[model samples]
Every structure is written in C-alpha cells, then in structure tokens.
Target: MGVLDQLRKEADQKKLSEQETVDQQALRAKLYKTQVLPKMQQIFKYLQELAEHLNYLEVPVQVENYSDRFPRLGTLMQKDYKINTDGYGGFSDFNKLVQINLTFYCIGKGELEYNVQTKSAIEQENAFLHAKRVASKMYRLGGAGREESAKFVVTKKIPVRVRFEVDYEQSQIKVMVNNHTDFSTYTEVWQPADIDDAFLDTLARYLLRKDSEFVSLDITDEDRNELRKKLQSIKHKEEQERLRGVTEQKNSGLEKKEKLGDKMKSFITGKINR
Candidate 1:
C-alpha cells in the first residue's frame, strides 16, 4: 500500500519498541510534508489534466419536429447535422449525408420550406416485382447468390432529395435539382443496397432509362406470388429464439434445483436442532 504502512507492518511482526515506532512515524510525517505529499499532489493534478483531455462525451442532438412552425430565421448552412457513433442519428444508418448549405428564404410577403423523403421507401413497394424477375432469371442462371452458378439481384435503390419551396402567400413555388449538391463538392456517395441484373434492368428500363425519363415506376403488386416466395425464403431466421429458449430452460432447471436444495437444508437443520 504505502511505505509507512509496510514499515509499520514489519515493525509489528518484529515487536519494535514504542520509542522506535514514534521516531519512525515522526520521520514519515516529515517526509510526507517535505516530499511525498507534494509529489502526490503534482501527480494528482497531472492526472486531472490528462482526464480532461481524454474525456469524450456524446453531444445531445435535438430532434426537429418536421411539422412545427419554422423558426423566424436560421441557417442549415450554419449548423452541421453531427453524426452519432452510438448508432442513433437524425438520418438512417446507411445515409451518406451529402452536406447541403443553402439559405432558407421568405420572399417578399411569404414563408419558405422544403419536403424530404427517402428514396428507399419509394422503391421498397416494388421490391417483390424485382424479386420475381430475379427468380425467373436465376433459373436460367442455374442458382442464386452462392459459389455455384447463381443469380444476383442486380438492382440498387438510389436516393434523391427533391426540394420544392412555396412562398407564404402560396403564389410562388421553386423546384430545384442540382447537377452538383448545394454545398461542399457533393462528397457523400452511399450505395445502400446491391442489385443484380433483373431488378436493375427492369427499374432502369421502366423508370430511369433515357427513353423512360418522363416515367417513374414506383408501385408494386404485394399480392403477387413472387412476393410470397421472397417472404418464404427468409421465413426461418428463428435461431436466436431457439437459443434463448434453451437458455431459459436451463435457468428454470437451476432455479428449481436451488429451491429443492433450500428445502432439504431447512429440513436437515430442523432435525439437527431437535
């Protein structure tokens, strides 16, 4: 523990004289006053300084109510949507937040605003149709996503941020699409999902191709048999539930044994006392 404690312990075992104990204690007090305490104080202060530098804490993010009335004036350009490391953030997990810095304006006598929606949510409706075409093609390819001959879902959902602003009197509207994002060099590129030949080609051909520039294929048939097959494929991911059931059974057995042992111990103790 400490030099003084060690010496005192040694002295106790060796049966030192009272005068010697007093003398050593006095010497220790002097050393503490002159050397040890000051050094310990310095070390404590250094440690406190180091702790302040090492400390890292999460910044509490304020969630904006999308339906709330707009603040009189503020800039998204002035504020950064900080990324959270603990897996909770304003945006989705896979979102590559392309920073856009633009001033929200109220022109003449009107208020201004923009509506945001995820590209994934829009495509998820048609996911079954994509899967059906994929399965159909996979038969020709002879397999699925495996080492052997298989088909890959060659479709990816691309996110788009559509900005439409209306003035307070509702007389004016602005619809803007940037060749480059509104701010700092369009840096965030997030490929959220991978697609194989079937879905991609269908979506591209139906909505995003040069010939399909005016069309958007956003709806899907959920009652389709292809959708049911997709659901059936992922149906039994219950291994976790199975493991939990086993653990619960073991714990229950242990609890029953403990109760039985307690009852036996009490009965034995009663007999012994009698």
Candidate 2:
C-alpha cells in the first residue's frame, strides 16, 4: 500500500476509537444518572432513617462516606457506618466490645448491595473463644468433652446482606436477602417488587430488626463436639493443676509441723537430761 493511504487509514482508526471511547463514557454517565444515582439517594435516606432509629434505641452509631476509597468512576460508590455496642456492656455481658458494620455499595445498572457484619475488638481466635464461652453458658456445646477434647473453639462470622437490582431490560426489580454469615450460601429472606416508599419502609424495618437480633454463627455438629471436648480438657487440666498445688501445700505444712515437734522433743529431753 502507498504511504499516504496507510497514514490515512491509521488516522481514521484513531478517530473511530476516540469516538467510541466518548460514546462509552456518555453511556456510563447516563446509566449512573438514571439508574445508579436514585438508588444511591434512596440508600442514603434509608441510612439516615436507620441512624435515627438506632439513636432512638440508645445505640451509638456513626455513618461515614467511603466513596473516596474507590476510583471516582461516578458509576460506583460505597458508604459505611458502624454501631458501637461497647457502652452497652458488650455482647452477652462480656468485657469485649462488639461493633456492627453496615456497608452500602452503589453499583451501576441500579444495583444496591448492603452488607451487615459483626466486628470484634479482639482477634479472630479470641472471638471464637468468646463464642465458645457463650456456647458453654448457653448449653449449646454438644459432645465436645465426652469424645474429643482437642477441638474447643470454632469461630466464624456469617454476615447478613441485602441486594437490590433493577433489570431495566427485563423491567423488574430483583431483591435478595442473605441473612447468613456464610457468604458461600444465601437464603432468600425477602423479595420486594420495587424500591418504592413501602419497600423502603419495609427494608428499614427489616434492618432495624436485624440490628436488634444480631447474626449468630452457625456451629455444625462436628464443631460443637470438638469445642465441647476442648473446653472439657482445659477444665480437667486446670482442676488437676489446682489439686496438685493444694496437695503440695498440705505436704509442706505437715513437714513443718513435724520439724517443730522434733525440736520441741529435743528441747524437753535436754531439759530432762540436765
């Protein structure tokens, strides 16, 4: 091909690419305005209402805008808030404080995802220990000490989530709730038609209910048995050590008493001899 012809073709292709890029940007902006922005606003309002509800319940809560944590794409954003129950004397009367996190993700195509998680002030292992301690007190520990005494704590958190998506092409709103901590599996708790006033009210009420009734991690039979066994073994070892310490103290006391008696006898004998 001629040099001029090749150059012309390259220029045409570059122009076409630029046009396509501009078109894609325009489409994304349109989607964000029509689909994403409304949902985002709705979520913000819902969060405000939720915060008010939590305040009414006397729970300390703070909402934060975390959209800057992601790229400023305008099509996606996130907001996070935390409910601090530390002042409430922690979970189940434990000294440790528990913070509940609520994260809202606004995605393109009219999709809003909400995640509710339990945040522990302690390490994951200690969280499991606390759970085990609660389980022990609640009598939820089954067959741990009777069979295997090695597995004492099974710690995990299953966060709850609610997802709302608008299928513009399909002309329907898809709503799903996964109230289980195990993200791998989802249980459909509620299905709403549209993000209308009624739906928003219902969603707010549902979230409030969840806030009051915290998510509980599911402990399988195997885990329960193992935890019980480990707790039993620990208790048994502690008891043994305590008994050993007491026995040693008693023996030491006896030895000291015998030595005193011997000394008294020697003194009396010397007196008699004298």
Candidate 3:
C-alpha cells in the first residue's frame, strides 16, 4: 500500500477506537444514573420507612447521618435504636438496654447491616426475649438469620449481627446472621426479585406471632391476626381500585374512537351532499 493510504487507514482506526470508548463511557454513565441510582434510592426509601415504622411502634429509635463514617462508600445512612427491657422507661439500668445499629451502603452493590449489642451481662431470659423482638422486626423487613441470632443471644449475650448484602449486577442478596458467641453464622442467599414488602411483612408478622407464643406481651395473637386480616383487606381494595382505573381508561379510549367515527361519517355525508 502507498504510505499515504496506510496513514489514512491508521487514522480511521484510531478515530473509530476513540468513538467506541466514548460510546462505552456514555452507556456506563446512563446505566449508573438510571438503574444504579434508582435502586439505591429505593433501598434508602425502604430503610427510611422501616425507621418510621419502628418509631410508630413506639420503639426508641434515632436516625443519624452517616455519610461521613464511610467516606469511601459514597452515600451511607445509619439509624440507631435503643430497646430497653422496660418499655419506654428510658433504660432504667444501663445493662437492660440493647442498642441496635442499622447501616445502609448506597453505592455499587448495596449493603445493609443490622448490629445489636448489649453492654450488661447477657441474662439468658432477657437476651432471648430481646433477640426475638429484634429479629422479628428485622425479619419483617427482609432480613435473615433469626434462628441463629436467637440461639446466639440465648447462649451468650454479647452482640448479634444480621447483614443483608445485595449485588445489583448479579441480582442476588446474601444474608448472614452472626453472634459473638462461637462466631456461629447462618447464611441465606436470595434473588432480588424474591424480596418484596409483602413477603417481608408476612414473614415478620409470622415471626412476631411465633415469638409471642413464648413471651407474654400486651399484643395478643388475636390482635395480630386481626391486623393481618386488615392488611389483606387493604391490599384487596388497592387491587380493586387499580383494576377500576384500567377499565375506566379503556372505556375512555373507546368513547373517543366512537366520537371520531361519528365526525368522519358526518364529514363524508356533507362532502357527498355538497
């Protein structure tokens, strides 16, 4: 080939390569903004909802800004809840309160950590009761490791940790529940599609009801069952409303088509008559 032709071919290839790189970068940025950002926002929204639900349930919970704690992780949110043996009495004994920390990582694959710790000695009875309460609440929100954490608290009271780590790329979630005692861990793997609010709520309510069987509290089985039924009824009503909306939209479209047909017919008749 001539020297000029060779040079031209090289220039063309170089330009194409540069354009491809730019296209790839643009695609990556679009994916991050649309898919990754929305997933992070959804996780953050649910976390906020969980915190609100706890507060509504009269649990002493505090939400804190933890963006600075994990500077490398981009955006992070944390919430701390203090659960005392005595309900709402502001922790009469330092040892009687269990501190639960929840952290959410909002970049790359999202990670949620639920760590519970007690400063006082682990009383098996109190520890068991506390673990059940904490686990039940966490499980309701798509957390796993309840049995193992309960066992850990029952045997040795130091700290129980349950973590839900999600990989958006792989669409998978890994759950680990662990305790300081024996370093025992329970692991569960799930697909992101399998985790939903309804599933989590149902599981959580079931756990709470099971726990109530052992611990005597003001909330009874009847009360829980009633609440479950009420929630189901609400869901049914929502579905009905959604169906009604779709039907109305279909009817509106049909009405518009009929009006257009009548106008067309009138126009044709007018033209013929003229």
TM-score top scorer: 2
Tens digits of lDDT, candidate 1, 30-60: 6544444333333233323422432333222
lDDT of 3 at 86: 31
Name the better of 1 and 2 by TM-score: 2
Per-residue lDDT over 4-78 for candidate 2, one digit per residue giving the tens place of the 0 to 100 score = 999999999999999998987787566655655465456445655675555566543222231332222234221
Model 2, 170: alpha-carbon shift in Å? 14
lDDT scores of the candidates, listed in order = 0.31, 0.41, 0.41
Which residue pairs of candidate 3 clash?
none
Clashes in candidate 1: how many?
Answer: 11
10-103 in candidate 3: lDDT tens per residue? Answer: 9999999999989877875665455444443443345446646754674432222322322333332222322322333233333221222232
The TM-score that candidate 3 achieves is 0.30
Ranking by TM-score: 2, 3, 1
Give the distance in Å from residue 158's predicted Cα in candidate 1 to where it truly belongs.
Answer: 40
